[model samples]
Target: MKIFKKNLVKMTMKMVGSLALFLGAMVIVPTSLVGSHQPKCPDELLK
Candidate 1:
């Protein structure tokens, strides 16, 4: 019973960690891509 509980806890931790990682990548990837595609400011604007 103790071994089973330990395995369950390990599995739950792994699942939660993977889920957080997946969500973070999902959000960051699109924003990064969009930022990369955005047009630069005009030269006149820098003056």
Candidate 2:
């Protein structure tokens, strides 16, 4: 059982956690700054 444990497993878990945090910020912070710069469509919608 002891042999099953490894340092690489711990490091991999930490890396996955950090990557999740970075991805969360990417979706959240940008939306606040973007505000109302969205594009609008009209003529195409009528067809």
Q: How close is each model in CA RMSD to the real structure?
A: 1.5, 4.9
Residue 17 local lDDT, model 2 = 100
Which lDDT values do the candidates have, in the order given? 0.97, 0.84
Q: RMSD in angstroms, candidate 2?
A: 4.9
Model 1 has an lDDT value of 0.97
Candidate 1's C-alpha runs over 4 A off are none
**Tens digit of per-residue lDDT, candidate 2, span 1-38:** 55456677887899999999999999889987897676
Which number leads on TM-score?
1
lDDT of 1 by residue, 1-47 (tens): 99999999999999999999999999999999988886789999999
Which residue pairs does candidate 2 place in steric collision? none
Best by lDDT: 1
